[model samples]
Target: MSDPSEMSNVRILGDFRGDPSPSTLRLALAQVLPSDAESRPSAPDQSTAGKEDDSDGAELAMQKLRLYAQTAASQGADVICFPEYFLTGAMHSSWKAVRERQEPVAAHPNPEEDESHWLAQVAAIARESDIDIVAGTVVELGAHHIPHRKDAQHKTGGPGSASKESSDSAVASKTGLRLRTKDSSDLLFNTAYYITRKGEIAAKYTKRNLWHPERSVLSPGHPSSHPSPRLFNIETRRGLRLKASMLICWDLAMPEAFRELLQPSDSRDGPLDGPDVVFVPTCWYATDAGVKGLRWNRAGEAAVLDSLSMARALETESIIAMCNIAGPNWPNGGDAHSFQINDNTKDEDLPIVGVGHSSVHAPFLGCVGKVEDGNEALLLAEIDTKLLADARDTYRVRYDLADAV
Candidate 1:
C-alpha cells in the first residue's frame, strides 16, 4: 500500500489561468511542432512531401520539444503539459497510417512496434527531467493480430477485425481474449493519456465526445455511470488519487459533456475525491495562434471559446488548463497551409476570420494563453485548486445541480 501523504501537494502547471501567480508554480509553455510544417515553403510542392522526409520533420519537432521540455524543467515545473500531438500531428490519420494500416473498424496498426518505442522515448524524457507529462493524445497500437485490439491487457486501444489467420493462431495459442470497444489488429484509440511520475500511463481517457470528422476516426467514450462532477482520478504511487481528467477540444462546445466528467472516481467521501483540475487538449483549426487576429473560422469567435470554458468553470469549479497548437496546423493532415502572427506578424495584421488559435481559460478570468504560431505551444500556469468552492455559491449553479441530482 502507498503512503497517504505522497499526492497531497500537486504543483499544477499548464496554460489556463491568466496572470497566474508568476512565482508560485513556475509554468513553462511547450512551443513544439504541430505537424510537418514548413515556416517558408520553397514554393509549391517543391518541398519534401513523402513519408521519409516527414521522419526528418518528426525529428526536428522532437528536438524542439526536448529543448522546450528541458527549458520547463529548468524553470522548476514539477509537471509539464504540451498541446495535442507535441511529437506527431493532432489528426489521428497519420498515426493510423504510419503506425498501422486499417480500413474503418478493422484496420491493423501496420507499424505496430513503433508506438511503444515512441512512448518509451517520451517517458524517458519525462523521467530524466524529473517532470510529470500530460502527453497529448497519442495513438496506442493494439497487440491482437486481428483487425482490432481489445481486452484487459490492452484497454483503450482494442481489436478491430479478427483475421482468419490471427483467429486461428488465437485458437491454437489458447489466449482467451474477448473484444469490447476495440479488437486485436492494433486498434487505434484517440486518448489524452496522462503519465505519472513513475512513467506509466496513470489514466487513459478516450475522448468522451467526438467532433466532426473525428467521429469517423475515433470512438466516443461511453459516459461513466457516476453522476458527479469528477470524471477520472489517478492515484499516485503514494496513494494520492489526484483528480485528473481530460476533455478534448471540440467537446468543449457541449456544456452537457462536463456533467459526465464532473462525477468523482474516488470511493472516498472527502473533497479530495473531487477533481481539483481539468485539462482541455485542443488542435485549434479556427485561428492561427502565431498570427494573432486571424482565424480559419471567424464564426468560432472568442465568444464561443469564452462561453464554452466559462460555463464549465463556473458550474464545475474546477481549474481548467487548455493547450493548443499555435502554428500552421495545415490540412486536416497539413496538406494545406496557413500562417500565424508569431511567424513575423502582429495580431492586428490579419483578419479575425478563419484564423482561430488555441487558448487557456481559467475560472476567474479567461484567455490565459493564446498561441499565434503554426506549431505546438504550452500555456502553463498554476490554478487555485480551491476555486471549486465558489461554484456552490452560485445560486443558479447550486439549484441546477441539485435539481439535476
Candidate 2:
C-alpha cells in the first residue's frame, strides 16, 4: 500500500466529489477485496431524508466515510482518488440550482471555510494513513477574488464578481489562466486542480468545453484560440509522467475536446506524441434510469468520449479516467429546469446520482483490475511507468509539431 506512496517521488490525484462534504476527506488508493465480503458495486443513496440537515449531517457522513477511507488505506493503497465536491452536498446542490440566478448561493457558515477544513483533514489523513489524496473541489470563492483581465488581475471584488471595480478571474498566478469554454461573453472557468500527496499544487486546469448553463458560469479554456485546449499534464508520484487531465461534465460531450487530448498535431505534430491518458472529473447526473451509470449528457456523448478516449489511449498508449460524482440527488428531482441563463437539457429525469466507473485503461485501452461503482471512492489501477517510458522513447510524444522533423 505504502509502496506507491514511498516510491512516489510525486503523486497525482483525480478527485470525484460526488456531492459536498464541508468537512475532511480521507481517500484511499484502493481497497483490497475481502474473500468473504461480496463485491457489491456501490451506487447512490436511495434515501433523501438527510437533505435538509447540515453541520451534524455533514459530520455523520464524514464518520461513515472515515471507515471507507480507512479500509482502503489499511489495505496498502497509496494514491486515493475521490469525486468532485466530496465535502458538501447541501452547498453543491444549492449552488447548482441557484448559480445561474441573480442571487448567489451562500453556505450558512462560510464558503471558504469549507475547503480549508477539508484540506487540513486531507493533509492529516495523509500523515495518519501514510497515503496521498486528491480531495475534490469546494465552492470556496464566494468572497475575495478577481478576474483574469489585467486590470482585474490584482483587483478585489465584493462577494461574487459583480462590481465594475472587480477583477477578472482568468489570469492565474504562475499556472496561467483557464481555457475559456463558453462563448466570449461568458466567463467562468470550470476549474480543476492537481495536488501532490505532499499536499502541494502540481498543476491546475479548467473545463474547456462548457455544457450549457455551466458555460455561463465559465470562461473559455486557456488554449481556446489554439488548435486545442483540453488536457492536463500531471507528474505522477512514480516519477513516470502522467498526462492525466479533465473535461468537466459537459465537456465530455464535445468531440473536438477529447479528440485534441489524444492527438498531438497542434502542440507536437502527430500521434504518439505522449499524453496517452486523459482524465475527466465531472458532476455528471444521469437522467435515464435504465442506464447502468451516470454519463455526460448530450446524446451518447459519454460513451462516445469513452470510446474515443479509449481508442486514443490505445493508439497513443495513454490512459483516460472519468471520475464522476456518485450518489443520487438528495431529493431526486431536477432535469426539467434549464440553467436559467438559457441552457436547457433535452431530458428531464436526469438523476443527480454521481455514479462512477473509476477504472484505469491500459496502453491498449483495456481496463485494469476493478472499477469504482459509487460516488465516494478511490479506484486505483496500475499505470505502468515502464510502458510510458517505452512509448516516450520509442516515439517523441511531448509535442507533435514542436518536436516534428
In candidate 1, stretches whose alpha carbon ends up further than 4 angstroms from where it belongs are 1-28, 38-53, 91-93, 99-116, 143-187, 221-242, 264-273, 287-303, 329-357, 372-376, 391-403
What lDDT, from 0 to 1, does candidate 1 have? 0.49
Per-residue lDDT over 1-405 for candidate 1, one digit per residue giving the tens place of the 0 to 100 score: 112232122222343334334223333445444654543231222223333435666667665555566555655554566666555554344555545433332232322224545556666666666666677665444332232333233222237856655554453333232233244344445556566555665555655555554444443444331112335554422233346567777778777766655543243432222345567766554433324334344334445655676677666666566566555334444322343335665543442122234554555655555544444444455544444455544434534554455
Work out the TM-score per prediction.
0.61, 0.54
* Candidate number of the best TM-score: 1
lDDT of 1 at 203: 58
Give the whole-model CA lDDT for all candidates, comma-separated.
Answer: 0.49, 0.42
What is the number of backbone collisions in each predicted candidate, taken in the order shown?
Answer: 72, 52
**Position 75, candidate 1: lDDT:** 50
Global fold similarity of model 2 (TM-score): 0.54
Q: Candidate 2 on 76-193: residue-level lDDT in tens?
A: 4445554444444422232232234212222323322345454445554555555544444333332212333442355456677555422333333222443323333223234454
